[model samples]
Target: MRVRNVRLIDGVSAQAVQDAVLECGDDGRITYAGPAARAPEPRPGVRTIDGQGGTLLPGLFDCHTHLGVPSDRSLVEAALLTDPVLGVLQTTERMKRTLDAGVTSARDLGGLPAGFRDAVAAGLVPGPRLQTSVGVLSHTGGHADGTLPGGKSLDLDYCEIADDVPGVRKAARRMLRAGADLVKICTSGGISSAHDDPDDQDLLDEEIAAVVDEARRHRGRPVAAHAQGRAGVLAAIRGGVRSVEHGFGIDDEGCDLLGERGAFLVPTLSTVFQPLDPRKTTPWRYQKKLRWNERAKENIAAAIARGVDIAAGTDAGISPHGGNLSELSYLVELGMSPMAAIRAATSASARLLGVEDTLGTLRAGYAADLVLCAGDPLRDIGLLSAPEQIVLVAQQGVVRKLTLPERSGSCQT
Candidate 1:
């Protein structure tokens, strides 16, 4: 497949190539992507697509997502009351919507079952390429602990209640055995956990070290920590976590620690501003969101200023699925340049997921996952917020979504 008459960002370059042409081979890999004047001639009977002066770039990546649960349901209902079969069906539809929104790749931080990833890879579902952290490990009363006041704990497949160093090690091995691509753990409290404040530290340093050691040493998998407070963030970094999710309470010292350790921060800034149904969101959750909303941007901006790597993530289960790209606009507002913001969702995110070699950039020998927008996103990143602007989406050289202007004749030249 060949796509021509477009501007290309390539995801690695600082600028776009005008009148660019991109070619993908039958083997699902890019063959050529550069200025049209320097491109090779099309093979006989090959399909061609005219991009109509659109901007083509590498397919986007949502570094953090939870595709298993419905967004409208509260945590308690989603974990305890959701029917297993119905939940799978709902998640499948959400996956299609996510792909339609142009997210070709996503990392499920927690709450996603591994079967969805297998299904997408096997072509049984229409969705973005997925990497999952089968479940999340947390200490008792931590952010992931879903216990009721009556002493009954939530029986969620995605939540593992572990305590101390030995218990966490065992839980980490269980997740790895379950085919988790990465191990996820909660080191601090969050908005949804009504029992603890967002600033409350949850896990011990030894416990974090044990999980990280278990994950990294056993199968060479990376660990992602749900850390929002300063102490938790620092502990996760020191324990060799690969990424820190939601570092809302990080200070300068924490920023310096992150920079020194070379850990990427997947800031889910959209979580604070996400619209929630009043009937579902409790009063305490709403109050916690308001408090975090006030300082989330400032802390993330400070991290960017300190040269800490920032990757884009929406915490999509909190925000809505299919609106993953909205996080980029928030990053731009947090002082990242348009190109930088795009990179955060593209190349930088792929690096965080450890798939930079085969994905991310629009270069030859890479997977042919691409997206075409009606206008240049560099001028106004908000254009991405409008779903209509997404003209086409392709994964592994196969066209998944396309909306081109009706031409008078065939595209073949």
Candidate 2:
């Protein structure tokens, strides 16, 4: 299929082409993408379509999401009570909402199993191209442990309790064996979890290193650390993890260390301004968020200024699934330029997932995942939040949503 008459944001750079043509092969890979006049010739009888002067962009990627499985107990009970069958129906539905929201690719931090990713890959599910961490590893009373202070532990599907280097290593291996694309380790306490200080260091340096080493050994799936506080951020960086998630307490020293180590940071700003349920938030979590919100943004601004790489992550399951794209606007409000925020959501995020070579850009040899918006995102980044503004969404060359009328025409070559 040849798509013409659109301004293309290739995802490689900030510039958009006024006259562009994108050709997708039967194998769902982009064959040619360039200016209309510079496009390669299409085969005979190949169908061509006018994009109606829309803005074509590489489909956005959401780096951190739970895919609607609910990390907390209240959300889990609600899901079970509301659905008659396994959460499969609800899970797929939420994922489709993500795709419908113009996100074609996403990484699931937890709250999903290996079967889900396989289903999406095998065409058994209608959702984004997904990479998942089957479960999260945390210390016994750490962020994801689901244990109240000095109390019995609650069994949860999304978390595995691991206290030491060996325990964490075992948990990491289990997730890898379960087909996790990356390993997730809780290096510190978090806001959403029960009975733990968000600023307290949870994992030892050796334990962090163990997870990273174990994951990197098996196909080099980089370990991601959930660190919202100072000591944890420093440990993650020093331990050589690929990216730090949340990073709500990263400081100047931490920022310099991140740049020096070439590690990336995925900051979920949406959670700060709009938490899972502001009204239901515990005083502890509320105070924690309030304390770190401004500091996190300041660290983010510092990260941006210091050229420390940053990616877009919404902590989606905490918010709404389809609301992923709203994160780009938050990044912009936090001091990123509109184009910079878009890149962070797209190509830059693909880099975080280590798929930038093929998935992120709209160029030859890349996956045919693209979104065509009615307006140029470069001019108005907030337009992405409006479903009406996104005229079409294509995942791997398959059109998922198309509000634009199909225009049948011969190649205008």
Cα deviation at 140, candidate 1, in Å, is 0.6
Highest TM-score: which candidate?
Answer: 1
- Whole-model lDDT per candidate: 0.86, 0.83
Q: Could you tell me which 10 consecutive residues in candidate 2 have the lowest summed lDDT?
A: 71-80
Q: How much does candidate 2 score in TM-score?
A: 0.94
Q: TM-score, each model?
A: 0.96, 0.94
Model 2 misses residue 324 by how many Å? 0.6
RMSD of each: 1.8, 2.2
Q: Pick out the ten consecutive residues of candidate 1 with the lowest summed lDDT.
A: 404-413
Report, for all candidates in order, the number of backbone clashes: 0, 0
